[model samples]
Target: MAEVAIRGVHKSYNKVPTVHGVDLSIADGEFVVLLGPSGCGKSTLLRMIAGLEEITAGEIAIDGTVVNALEPRERGCAMVFQNYALYPHMTVAENIGYALKVAGTRKPERRARVAAVAQSLGIAELLDRKPGTLSGGQRQRVAIGRAMIREPKVFLFDEPLSNLDAKLRAQMRIEIRRLHQRLGVTSVFVTHDQVEAMTLADRLVVLNHGRIEQIGTPTEVYRRPASRFVAGFIGAPAMNFLTGTLAADGRIAIGSGAGTPVTIGVRPDEIQLLDAPLKGTLDFEIELVEELGTGQVFYGRSGEMEMTVMRNGGGEAALPRSGQRLFLKIPMTCVHLFEVESGRRIDLPPSRLAAE
Candidate 1:
């Protein structure tokens, strides 16, 4: 395993910068994920670390050695691409051992290594099958096995599960997590999927446009987002944002189109259907309710903004019909305040925002 250090890294095409100056340190054996929307430079950054993209400025070092000038193979890293880049005609065994063969390992040793990796990946029985004969998941495993056989110090996965079905993606995520735990290799994964980033990463580096938005453990980013962008991007059904003004008592006064003040931004799960706290209750018109097995998501329009509420299994039964008026209770603690102009979080004292 090796630590990767990126110092003031920058990249561009024809003088138009795509990756702004960025610095990040990845610890040895740490599973770090680069997460962002498309065109955010996450993949470009990964490719730069893999030595596939040339660095326009600054340095990339692996295990304390400067590798900006090194080739991809010499950087001691293996990259698994979005597309399963397997040789069509090559059998699984041949594909897995191809890199070893290229490095001139003896045929016997290569076969042994291939078999060991295949067994570890539970693909031993499929060794002789060609790529065309394998399922999507199996082909992906062969792609991963090929990388494993190289025994590189760093593993780079660029949206490796993007092509798989939902069920397969979930299963492969567990398998990948287990494999990483067993191998303990330094890994840099790039993905646009927030759930994958949340579940798989030891730490997530959130990127925006060509710069870093926030970097933290998944829990930290989820619970205490550094920016409104991070807050909205990291959550499912996303965090609700409503424009409001901070009042004298540190309370946020939401404004109606006609200038009436209302409270804003209590997460759906945090909003309870209750009778008390009349001041925090808002009338909502239920537009739809989705049943998701263990829970139901209530989609409604509160004033002018659309709001989503996640209820743990009982919401559907109690939810009102479309266009019906219902009171949604907002607990003060779950409300996140953001500056209307700057789109930055408002740091309110706990005492002021705390629930009574």
Candidate 2:
């Protein structure tokens, strides 16, 4: 296991920068995920660390040794690509032990390492099969096993699960996490899937347009986002944003053209159908109801403001219907206020906004 450090790194093509100056330190045995939308430079940054891309400026060091000038193989890192880059004609055993063979390890030792890695990845029985004879998930395992046989200090995953089916992807995700825990090798996984980053990473590095947006543990970024971009990007059904202003008395007023004053952001889960605070309730026209097993998501127009509400399995006897008016109660504590112009969060003191 080795720690990887990137200092003021920059990369470009024909003088047009793709990766801005990025400084990141990935601890030994830590699974740090680079997460962002496509064209956001996450993959470019990963390639740079793998020594696949030349840095326009700055330094990269692995295990305390500067390796900006080193080749990918010399850097002692193994990369698993988005496409399962397995040899079509080579059997699983041959593919996994090819690197060892090239490095001139004897047949016995090479076979032992291949079998060990295959067993760890649960693909030992498939050793004699060729890539074409295996399923996508099996092929991916072979790809990973090939990398494991190299015994590199750092493991780089470039959206390795992107090509698998949804069910297979979920299964592979758990397997990958378990494998990492068992091997305890330092890993950098790049993916655009927010759920993948949230569930797999020890820490997530959120990127936007070739620059770092925020870096934190999954819980920290999800709970206390640094900016509106992050707040909206990290959550599912994404956090709804309504333009509003801070009143002189610290109240938030939102709406457009004869709009009502809505001082708070009510997370879907926080809003409830209740009788109390009758005056505070917003009248909503239910447009859709999606039943998601344990809960249901209500989507509708609350006056001119769009809103979503999450309700547990059992609630008030009456279920909302299309075009029906319903009162939605929003607790003050669940509200998040932000400065309208700058889009930064407002640190509202507790004394002013009393909670239920």
Candidate 3:
């Protein structure tokens, strides 16, 4: 296990900058996920860490050693790629022990090491099988085992589960987490999937347009996103942003009106759909409804703004139909405020004003 320090890292391709000055310190054994949308430079940053891409500027250190000048092999980092880059002709044992064989470790010792790693990955029985014969999850386990056999100081995963089915991805997540617990290896994962980022990361580094937007634990980032981009990107259905004005009484006056122009942000799940009329309730016209087995997601429009509402485990009678008009209450405590012009989050006490 080793700590990773990234200081003023920058990258560019043919004079076009892709990764700006990014500084992050990853503690030993911590699982850090770099999250963002496409073209956000997350993959570029990960590649730089693995020494697969050269840094245009700045320093990277592993276990207190500057590794900017070192090759990937010399940096003591093992990277697992998304494609499960295994040799089709080689058996699982050979693939897992390839590094050892290249280093000239005796076959007896290499086989022993491969056996142990495969056992840990719960694929000991498949040691003799080729990757083509294995299931996606099994192949992924082999890929992981190959990395594990290296016993590197840090583990780098570049969207390793993107190719798997949802169920297999979930299972691999558990396996990877369990492996990290057992080995205590410092790991860095890169992905655009917010769910994968939220569930796998000890802390998330939200990146956008080559810059670091926010760095925090999943809970902190979800509860208190540092910027409007983060608030919208981290949640499913995204955060609902309504153009509005902040009232003198600390309440938000949604829609065009006279007051301080601002933006109100709230998650879909945070909005309460009131069956009966209440003070300060806004009218929402449902346009579509998606059944999610245990819950429902309603997509609709309120006045001129479009929004989504999520309800968990509501009975059939409670489900609202498309074209239905409902009342929505935005709890002040769950409200997020942002500057309309800058898109930056603003701190405000919970509004005391209720539905007027």
Local distance difference test values of all predictions, in order: 0.86, 0.84, 0.91
Best lDDT among the predictions, by candidate number = 3
Question: Per-residue lDDT of 28-60 in model 3, one digit per residue for the tens?
Answer: 999999999999999999999999999999999
Candidate 2 wrongly placed segments (more than 4 Å): 256-266, 275-277, 315-317, 349-356
**TM, every model:** 0.94, 0.91, 0.96
- Candidate 1 lDDT, tens digit per residue, 81-146? 899999998999999999998899999999999999999999999999999999999999999999
Model 2 agreement with the true structure over 1-356: per-residue lDDT tens digits: 89999999998999999889999999999999999999999999999999999989999999999999999989999989899899888999999999888889999998999999999889999999999999999999999999998988999999999999999999899988998999999999999999889989999999988988889999988876766667778877677666655555655445542332333444587778653338657777789988787777878887778888777886546666667677787666656765555556566677666623
Candidate 3, residue 270: how far the Cα is off, in Å:
1.1
Better of 1 and 2 by TM-score: 1
Clashes of 2: 0
Model 3 accuracy (lDDT, Cα): 0.91
Query: Which ten contiguous residues of candidate 2 have the minimum total lDDT?
Result: 256-265
* Residue 327 error, candidate 2, Å: 2.3
Runs of candidate 3 exceeding 4 Å displacement:
247-249, 350-356
Error (Å) of candidate 1 at residue 229 is 1.1
